[model samples]
Target: MQKNSQEKDEKLLEKRFAELSRTAFQRDIITYTDFLNLNEQNILHTLPKDTLYTRVVSFGGYELAERQMAAFIPDALYLRWGKSSDPLDYTEYPFSAVRIAPLNRKFAEELTHRDYLGAILNLGIERCKTGDILTDREGAVVFLHRDMAGLVMDELTRVRHTSVKAELLSAGLIDYSPEYEEVRGTVASVRLDTLLALGFSSSRSRLTGLIEGGKVYVNGRLITSNGYQPEEGDVISVRGMGKFRYQETGGKTRKNRISVVLRRYV
Candidate 1:
């Protein structure tokens, strides 16, 4: 049931991709899509290599963003500089930041990513229409499409009883790094299940179910093997769990086990 629905969604996405590229080529202009997750991006990457319609690129309104928008570039726009090698030089992504600041710092609650997203969804806005929501000490910065920035700014006033003020920031100006807590543990090996168990402090037996159930992704690519090993600096995302970064920072322990570190998202 769910598998069939997912297949249908992927097919629909492929069709949408072709249509956007066709429109961009026919009109000789750029066509864009709302924000896409890593799985959706993988679908786009699986499309045919040679496309006559347009070239595709993506940006999430700022650096170090996970959710992003895709732009289909026609030849006229892609080759404006005459055979330029860099895609970033030719394209201007249609995304901007909305700085959601608290009305009163003293009274503001410690907001979270879920809180901001919940407030945004409460505005009747679809999740696909928005990019990543970066949250921190002062407030959150939602990567919103240019079309609905005004609505978010005007209506998204209160998050969990804390009044917030929104301001539109210039695109491509904000720098973001996700917050994480350093966790160190000794694993028997750097296998996928072992690393995940270390990160979540779960038994490998249960973690194996997650890996085999298509719930684990390393650097945005799905991994299904319990024995699959992850490299250093690999970002792992577990559906319904949390994100983790794997790092092998030390040599073998005194017990001859591997010393590993996992940066768990806080």
Candidate 2:
């Protein structure tokens, strides 16, 4: 019975693959997040172990040409590029067309040094050093490796910037809203060591030991003082354990105990 069921499932998968292959594939723009989600759900499962995936980023006229190639040879590679119509929507679906941010108009007009790197940097975008590079008519371009693209996109979302549009583009899958609330109370007013004594740490002495051992970082910088008073907006990253941000200092209790909220970041 189990063998029959396994055979039936395999047949169904093959049928689905055949159906997908018969469809008219077209190039379209898709967000990096969307692309990754699709990969996790559809592409990865279907891809064979020996399958080879090629990613190309082009800046110029051959956009149509690339799409044509992808449609005919769907099983050979995956293509990602910016949407020509909307421009802003960087679509990565359908395995044919994917679009990222385009070159700036001013930069395109000058055309002195045509490269995707300049435009990516101008947009304040950073790609992993090990990513790919592709050039078309547009300029310098950054191509992320298939495996690492998602991670790079996630890291880019953490950067705060003045341009709302740019920020939106970079925030691929991250929620921008303030999700965690502030825990209020005087517990927040106490020093790091004191707070740890009140059950924040395994033991008060352990907290001090961590501090003296130089195993803590506040807001990306190392902090050594056990007496250091953390406030709202302060992020404490401890070695071995995860990090948390101090949210607020609540009013004092009748027993002089304080309340506080800490946002944990893994």
Candidate 3:
């Protein structure tokens, strides 16, 4: 039964790939991914050359990730496909950042990533039409399709209970830097459970549950094996826990445990 379902899903994914290629070949503008999961990304990578999209398709986010976030996570990725040789062409990419600020400091509610996301989603914009929503102490910055920039700038007046004003930030002036914290830890093994437990400061038992529950993805593939040994440069993402890059091992400790370095997206 599972194999049959897998075959059905693969067929659907193949159709999606064809649709994406057709859209790119027909439309001159760029397009984004429609919330691809880790399995789907692996399928995309392994697709036959003849079945693949011919144009340049670039993937990026505010932060780097192997199993990319569809929209809301810290390492959310935005896929852009266009005819230009330069992927950084702001004109062809047509991405705009909107700075949403609260009216009053004292009465203002502390906005979260979800708060900003929910507000933008409330505007009837599809998730793929937008990118990351970065929130700070004062306000939030939302990256979205340029076509919807005007609508967001005009109609986005309130975020939840907080009255806010949205202003369009110059495309050239927008910064896409990601914040992350370096972590050094020791693990008994390089297994998925060990590294994840060390990186998240959680128990191996807990991480095991997550891995078995299919909430862990590594290098753009859903990894269900807790004993799966991850290689250096592999990005591990735990749903609700955040994403991290597994750097090289720093040699084994006296106790035979491996010392590892990780960069957790903050």
**Prediction 3 global C-alpha lDDT:** 0.72
Q: lDDT of all the models against the reference?
A: 0.84, 0.40, 0.72
Please rank every candidate by TM-score, starting with the best. 1, 3, 2
**Model 3 Cα shift for residue 14 (angstroms):** 3.5
Find the candidate with the highest TM-score and give its number.
Answer: 1
When superposed on Cα atoms, how far off is each prediction in RMSD?
3.1, 20.0, 6.0
As a TM-score, model 3 comes out at 0.76
Q: TM-scores of the models, in the given order?
A: 0.84, 0.34, 0.76
| Candidate with more favorable, higher lDDT: 1 or 2 | 1
lDDT of 3 by residue, 129-192 (tens): 6766777887987777778889999999998899999998876665656677989989888899
Error of 2 at 261 (Å): 2.6
Over 70-182, each residue of candidate 2 has an lDDT whose tens digit, in order, gives 11123223323322333223323222111233324343332222233344444444432222233334332333434444443433321122111111223233222223333
- Candidate 1 lDDT over 1-266, as tens digits, reads 99999999999998999999999999988888889887887678768776337888777765446787888988777777555565567766676789999999999999899999999999998889899888788898888877779999889889999999999986556867777899998988889999989899899999999999988888766778999988999988888898888865688978999898889986
Q: Which stretches of candidate 3 lie over 4 Å from their true place?
A: 1-13, 22-43, 46-50, 53-56, 60-86, 89-91
